[model samples]
Target: MFALRRLSTVALSGARCKHSLPDLPYAYEALEPIISRDIMTLHHQKHHATYVNNLNATEEKLSQAISKCDVSTAISLEPALRFNGGGHLNHTIFWETLSPKCTEASKDLMVAITESFGSFDAMKELLSAAAVGVQGSGWAWLGYDPKIKRLRIAQCANQDPLEATTGLKPLFGIDVWEHAYYLQYKNVRADYVKAIFEVTNWEAVSKRYSKAAC
Candidate 1:
């Protein structure tokens, strides 16, 4: 698993700080055929990078506002903080939850999926439908509901972080934003959603599930 730096920590620190874009675990060409090299390069280097840069800038301003006790300025910065922070967090998890090659779910995860959604295929079906059904740019998530010890499928519009928006620990996320698929699949979002499964990093997701379950 990648060492994910949770963006919420940086946002709440109230100190001048910078959040750098994370390097991809695999080369941009790794997930090729399913997700093209061009798309991956642009998505990671361009799109996700923008979020990291904006987040660092926003946090710097937030720190200054807090230090001055400028209540109004601090309040005004909340939307920026949430937007950029969510973008950083969502993309960080999205990148890690994907792999160049297909992988299988851990045994424990398979059992949990059976209990939660009847079968592993059923979970994929639900998650795919949710991802394709998104109205616009957003993410479809398979999240762990700790209170019930169950897996749940949920969608978050735009860059909204799944955990913050739905109180579910994000185990796997499918980014349905245009930037994620437009270059490779054109306007056919469903095709992109369907193809992403070929490279789904189930091992990483299973680890996340285990942690969230605990």
Candidate 2:
């Protein structure tokens, strides 16, 4: 499986400090009707910013614990590390996977999808289904299984990072958190999940797939 590097920079105060929120690639309203400006604004500035903040804080504490040679304390921080770290990682991919502009699936990516799922439409349907099927706050992902050399649709509960939990390199992800679509789609998460395809940045996903396939 491809190694999913930690994107967040860790710098403790007594140790070192540089983790910051990543700027959105486009304006808040770029996705237009597919995703509302209010949704984008809150999702990125508030929700995602919270994750970054929490991750930095968690890392800071972990660093302190490590410095004291407190293995027990460091071990106790696993939940925070997994949750906040996964949140940050998932959001990073989510933001990049979506675009205001429509993007075509690359030939290689399309071939993989078709081979694995019968057709592009079939794969899209399955991915959408997976997203809509999430029980709670979770994600649906198009991930590459390096072992079988297959493209797969997987669902993850809570903020579990795709690669970390499943060892599948994530190509694209659809967040099912209420914070992601509650404003626009309301309780109709399926609609939101289906509509997300319109704004999907397939070019970005294709590039991720290319790397994962390698």
Candidate 3:
């Protein structure tokens, strides 16, 4: 009986460890005018969901290797875990950092942006340019440098997590993957970049900044 109970516990733990797609706070259509419903639906339900699923699958294989002390198999799973885990993390933050309603920058976030970039407008220009200039599929971010106690703009190629690549803490991010804007804005990525700000959730970004600072 005890052996059976132990086995059940291990199985349950493994099942609970699997990565799952997180639900958005708002409806798929809520971000309209800036991001179309179709884009949000497909991007979240399909693209991000795929990453979460794959990450879970890869991690399961990795766990089995670790339990057996198979170093080579563990090492072989690194790339998939990084790619898929980073995708899940980045997309999670991306969805949270936006809203349909236009909001003023939070006092804390605004102050940091002003102090670091000299003004919010400057930061916007810099971040927007980075978003538009990504050579391929990537992301543009407004991140906080804890060591410098300042804000900075950075870019990541593919699905690399911002914090993992740079020491900066991501506050807000914009997805530059063609899949992000191709359907609605087509090849006019500049327009997509321009429109994204209209719905930027400064409140959420501010919370992220505050948490990172802590």
Per-candidate TM-score against the hidden true structure: 0.92, 0.92, 0.92
* Model 2, CA-based lDDT: 0.90
Among all windows of 10 consecutive residues in model 1, the one with the lowest summed lDDT is 1-10
Candidate 3: where are CA atoms >4 Å away?
Answer: 1-16
Weakest 10 consecutive residues of candidate 2 by summed lDDT: 1-10
lDDT digits (tens) for residues 72-185 of candidate 2 = 999999999899899999999999999998799999999999999999999999999999999989999999999999999999999999999999999999999999999888
Off by over 4 Å in 1: 1-17
- Please give, for residues 130-179, the per-residue lDDT of candidate 1 as tens digits: 99999978999999998898999999998998888789999999999999
Pairs that collide, model 1: none
Q: What C-alpha lDDT, on a 0 to 100 scale, does residue 192 get in candidate 1?
A: 96
lDDT of each: 0.90, 0.90, 0.90
Prediction 3 global C-alpha lDDT: 0.90
81-172 in candidate 3: lDDT tens per residue?
A: 88999999999998888898867788888888889999999999999999999889999999999899989999999998999989899999
Report RMSD for candidate 3: 2.9
